[model samples]
Target: MNFTDIDPDKLFSSTDNSNPIMWLVWIVPIVVFMFYGQRIQLQITSGEISKNIAKLVKYKEESKKELLDYLQTNLKATPDAAKKIDGFLEYFTIMPVDFDPNGIIPKIKHLLRSREDYTRQQVKSLSPNMDALEVSKVQNLLEVTTSLHLLHKLVRHLFLTAKKQNNFPLILPLQMMIPFIMEQASALRDAVSALKQGQPIGDGIGPMVVGKMMLGTEKKTITFETVCAEKEFEQRKLYLLKAEGPTATVGRPGDAVELLVLKNKPDIIVMIDAALKLEGEDSGSVAQGFGAAIGGIGTDRFQIEEIATKNNIPIYAVVIKQSVKEAITLMTKQISDKAESVESQVFQIILENTKPNQSALIVGVGNTLGVPQ
Candidate 1:
């Protein structure tokens, strides 16, 4: 059965051999298949890119949400205040760090100098009859604005140095802390703007009222009138000191200040200063106590505190919570709050010491470092 079973004529192969059409049909599909396969691989890579982009968007939105919550919870709002805490956060978050030697620092210095000179000229041109308080307010605004740039440079230096570090220790903590500072700075900017516009200094207290309040604070008030020991209480108001540059020092318990205190013989001396956080302390925590007064260094703060202590005047301190950076950017709120807090404490001290000593001085110390004597 096996030997006779196969018939060659009926079996498998019968062909004329090579055909060009067959080669073309097979090759064309193979080429198309390879091309499609590569295209599909590329599509997979593109899909990965899209996935990463979506993830980045989600991450950014979450970050922004956290920032918003932090600001709203911590900051207070007022109609009179210019820089909302949120504004500062927004400003610093986007600040560019590319340093150029020729770009920033020098330009800021030049602009500040020019602005200062212009302010001096404007003051010189003021009429003798122009309200002195108005003139003084304008001058102070100009000076503060000009001086702020210096503080900004200091901040920039810190930021740049932090960026250059190999290991940025507490980087997240630093980031969290900086936004608070930005808020404070924004508030400062707003305060300066209000001052320039000659808006009322306090809610209901204009500069005139402020001057009067300072003069009327005690039976024997010391001011520009008392600066020269002259009795020009009629023509001269208390708050108007002669025009001095930003660096002019005021709080030094020098003869001028001492004489004022001696004349007043206040029952208590309460000093308020910005206190920085210790290494591991919370940023905005207040510390109240007593310490040495190093004269002549800080803006009249150290000197005045020193003078009060040296005279055996009972000294009390109210230190507001702040970072060193935050302290530099002072809006009126910090100063006002600090001043009121000290004033209240001073009164309390007087009540506590019923039979108190006659002469007392309330010193507002701290980085009076920059304020000239």
Candidate 2:
């Protein structure tokens, strides 16, 4: 066509539907740009997520190595022992059971007890030279290490899947959940530090209080793995029970309490534990109330309730508040410092609720990590 015959107005006019080529000319570049731009975005996002997954894998490996070194140095654990422990750690870390409402506590308790027994047996077999305390320490280290390893694996998997699917929506949710993941990871790291240093964890505040109360007192082995002692407070003969610690175990406190109730027949049963605080609540704040202040599978709490109810014993609970993150991590200065106040409050509760010369069972319900009975 001659240049004079081509009308500039006709070429640019949208109303001119006769020439569909004009429409294609305008639409083609936009479609191509969008398609290629999306591809580029997916590539960049996938690459970034892959790098993060790599870092997490590296972290998990480093944590595993540290745990292995600690086991070897402290427990004199052989390679076979280390391997068994690793397997045990991974088994518990994975926690094959999902949360169920009906009879969940019993199921959890059964699993935990079985796992504990298996782990103890393995530890004993692997580190025959190590004493109970050393075995406990090793177990604590394994628990902390497993938590960190599992967290890393979970986040890495999520990141990889999000990248693989090239789903920005999926990735956005995962990114939003990162803060929670990091919080848990940080707590696990702190827990590892506390376990290695033989320091009390925040969750151990209840046990620490019991330990302090039982200091200089004679402790008797109430169960195969639990201990108890007697203390005189406010004219009331208090029976203090806790897991024999410096190790990381809940130590059959429920079983110990059962034995104590049958033998001592205390008037009031007071249980202390670390409770998860709400967002606004200060960590280490003490609250006094009723019911079992125990955490974990409901076995221990159920035991306490069953025994207490049958015996017609009034159950009182004293709890030290901590964040979910703090509850599992190292004992903060705030939590440690609150121990004395909690003790005082506990004493007051006992005095107010009981008569002089009346016996009371004070059970500290938590993992006795560094607190000794």
Candidate 3:
């Protein structure tokens, strides 16, 4: 023992073959304990998890109470607002299946029924004197809703078919990232709920995603230095205008987009911007909607949208989803497995629909937040 007296050959040659399963027996319990411990730590550290769940519970209770209040108060629904809510809710409620399936339009159509009475009542509460023009806009919105419904249905059907055919791998790693996916979904659901309640959805997710750099308040002729950063938009008819704001803000809001559309008389407008998402989110979960005209929520998006609405121009928005850094790097592929498809959908809207007299304005909206102008 003192001087390596035991025979070296015997020690090296002899081996004990223990069951490999025995190692797991010792490891698994330790892993389970660690996992449970981490969950407890997470619960303590992230109050929002419990608070959000409580909020959901509170929302359900309030929704029930709202129904009761409507019945008791004889509150009427605002037709336009009701229509918007009903349409949004119809599509929002659908559970996503077949992670890669394309069904946005069909799904909306399937879920859309007659506008809820409560929704109509709420709309009336918000806007009592909604005009004929507003009514027409709501009708147009219904068409969009129908298309969304159809898209969802198509996605579901595609997924179902793929499942039957067994066309995909037996295991997809993307499915393993459920908790992250659920977090993003919950964030979206919460935002929508707040919207329905006319409440704020916080400065965390919404402002990071679709809300920024809103244009349009002063009405005048405007122009941008037309630079086609991406080839897909290059061939399409394009125009550019420059607007400088306070150090903290860049790109005009939605109201500006509307004013420009009316004054410049453009046929089509498109906004290209960087959209922020949670650290780990499904790349494909972009929730598109109407934007504001001036400095408000999603104002940048709204500016282009307002112009579209006012001048009867089609407004298409393409948002590159990334963290602030990734956005600067212009990484085409983000976390989603279907990044190509997402990019294609965005690019197609701008490129495929070009006509002889159409002018498209693509706004690269982001925080010129941290970048040098």
- By lDDT, the best candidate is 2
Clashing pairs in 1: 247-372, 248-372, 249-372, 249-373, 269-361, 271-363, 298-368, 298-369, 299-368, 299-369
Q: For model 3, what is the alpha-carbon lDDT of residue 43?
A: 38
Model 2's C-alpha root-mean-square deviation from the true structure amounts to 6.3
TM-scores for candidates 1 onward, in order: 0.39, 0.79, 0.31
How do these models rank on TM-score, best leading?
A: 2, 1, 3
Candidate 3 or 1, higher TM-score: 1
Runs in model 3 lying further than 4 Å from the true structure? 1-237, 241-248, 278-304, 323-348, 369-373
Tens digit of per-residue lDDT, candidate 3, span 231-304: 21354544443332211133333444555566567556655444665769644355343332122233245345
lDDT of 2 by residue, 307-362 (tens): 88999999999999998668877788999999899889888888888999898898
Model 2 earns a TM-score of: 0.79
- CA lDDT of each candidate? 0.40, 0.79, 0.39
